[model samples]
Target: MKTLKIFSLAAVSVLLSTVIIAQSKTETFKVSGNCGMCKTKIEKAAKEAGAKEASWNAESKELTVTYKSSSTNAAKIQEKNSSSRV
Candidate 1:
C-alpha cells in the first residue's frame, strides 16, 4: 500500500510539471528592420509587453520571444513590435 501511494504521488507530480511547462512557450518570428537600433527596439518592446525573454537579430530579421502563455501570446508580442516600428 505504501509503495502504491508513492507511485501515485509521483505520477501526480509529473502531471503537474507537464502542465507548468506547457504554460511557457518560445516562438520566433520575422521582423522588418535595418539597423542595430531596430533590434534594440524590437526586443525591448516585446519584454515590456510581458515577454520573459526577447531577442532580435537584424541580419536574419528573426525575433525569438519567450513568454508565459497564461499572461501573453505571440500575436501580442508581434503587434507590440510592429506598432513600435521596430
Candidate 2:
C-alpha cells in the first residue's frame, strides 16, 4: 500500500511538471518580400519578437518561425515582420 502511494505521487509530479513546461510552436506563413535584404529584415523582426529561430525564403516569400508559446505567438511575430518591411 505504501509503495502504491509513492508511485501515485511520482506519477502526479511528472504529470504536473509536464503541464507546467512551456511548449515550442513552429509556424510558417507567407510574407511578401523582394530580395535578400527583405529576408534579413523579416527574420530579424521575428527574432526581436521573441522567436527562437526565424528563417525567411525570398523566392517563396515564406517565413518560418519557432517560438515558445508562453512568451510569444505567431500573430505577434507576423505583426513585427510586417512593420519591419521597407
Candidate 3:
C-alpha cells in the first residue's frame, strides 16, 4: 500500500515535469546586424520577451533562442529584435 502510494506520487511528478517542459519551446533564426551593440540589443530583446537562453553570432548572423512558446514566438522575437544600428 505504501509502495503503491509512492509510485503514484512519482508518476504524478513525472507527468507534471513533462507538461512544464513541453510548454517551453526553442527556436533559432537568422537576424541582420553587426557589432557588439547589435549583439547586446538582440540578446536583451529575447530575454525580455521571456527567452530562457539567447545567443547571437555576429559572424554568422544567427540568433538562437530558447523561450516559452506560450509567452512568445519567432516572429515576435524578430520584430522586437530588429531595430536601429545606432
Best by lDDT: 2
Return the TM-score for each candidate structure. Answer: 0.73, 0.76, 0.67
Every candidate's lDDT: 0.89, 0.90, 0.83
Task: Rank candidates by lDDT, best first.
Answer: 2, 1, 3
Model 2 local distance difference test score: 0.90
Give the number of the best model, judged by TM-score: 2
Instruction: Name the runs in model 1 displaced over 4 angstroms.
Output: 1-22
- The residue-by-residue lDDT of candidate 3 on 59-84, one tens digit each, is 99999998877678888787777642
Q: Who is ahead in lDDT, 1 or 2?
A: 2
Q: Write the per-residue lDDT of candidate 1 for residues 1-86, one digit (tens) a residue.
A: 99999999999999998789668899999988888888888889999888999999888999999999878999999888878772
Tell me how far the alpha carbon of residue 85 in candidate 1 is from the true structure, in angstroms, after superposition. 2.1
Cα lDDT tens digits for candidate 2, 1-86: 99999999999999887766577889999989888888888999999999999999887888999998889999999998778665
